[model samples]
Target: MIRRIFPYPVLSVGFFATWLLFNQSVTPGQLILATFFGVTSPWLLVRLDAPPFRMRRPLMILRVLWTFAKDIAQSNLRVAKTIIASPHPPPSGFVRIVLEMRSPYGLAALACIVTGAPGTAWISYDPVDNVVVLHILDLMAEDDWAASIKTRYEKPLMEIFE
Candidate 1:
């Protein structure tokens, strides 16, 4: 009963908070609407055939998160230096990376991580070939980027999701 009522309680709470923030109100009517959205949004998503989210190793999340934060900081610095200090414009190119993560959730997370970081943009992903085309502001070596993405992000994500 509890599980059915709160399929995604954390998401529900977040949605409720977002609703309150958007409305900028705590009146009874707004509260009721917020509560309704909080409870029904997840239910609607489930009804829409959303995949069940599962984390195989929750402990690995800390390590992955730490690495992600460090990478973001480093990438920002690299991008900033390239833009500000480089005598010539940095090389740019699209590198096709073959993704190992098959799960939709895992792939989405990887896309977010890559695109969220500075200097890299996720252009397109080919589901049939499991390849992602990423545009880099400062192109160095394709092999190096592939190796970095595979070892640094994909491996850990695979452990977590698959």
Candidate 2:
């Protein structure tokens, strides 16, 4: 009986907590709505046949967060210098990176990390090829970008989510 109601317990709690946070209230009506969504969304989502999420090494999340913060800070300064201080337009191009990690959650995290940094955008990911395409403002550093992404980002994410 409990299983039928809370199909995904963690997801249910997340949905509930997120709703309450967005509303910033614990009033009766708000609680009702939060409860309704908390129970229903995950119940309906079970149809998607998504892979189960299992974090093998939860402590690695701190490393990923630290790396993301540092990269964002450095990228911001570099992009600003190129745009505001340079005389010439910085070279920009797309580069393809072969990815070994297949977890959807890890891929999503990777997308956030790449796109969150200044002067770089996620172009696309091809599942069949297991490759990710990224457009970077500094094309001359394409090789460095590819290697940095693999080691600085993907490696940590793979350990965290896969």
The best candidate by lDDT is 2
For residue 162, what is the lDDT in candidate 2? 77
lDDT of 2 by residue, 48-162 (tens): 8988879999999999999999989999999999989999998899999999999999999999989999999999999999999999998897778889899998998998887
Model 1: worst 10 consecutive residues (lDDT sum): 44-53
Candidate 2 wrongly placed segments (more than 4 Å): 25-28
lDDT of 1 by residue, 47-141 (tens): 77857778998888788789889999999999999988999998899999998889888898899999999999999999999999999998899
Task: Count clashes in each candidate, considering only residues at least 3 apart in sequence or on different chains.
Answer: 0, 0
What residue runs in model 1 are displaced by over 4 Å at the alpha carbon? 1-7
TM-score of each: 0.86, 0.84
- RMSD over all Cα atoms, model 2: 2.2
Residue pairs in clash, model 2:
none
Q: Please, what is the whole-model Cα lDDT of each candidate in the order they appear?
A: 0.91, 0.92
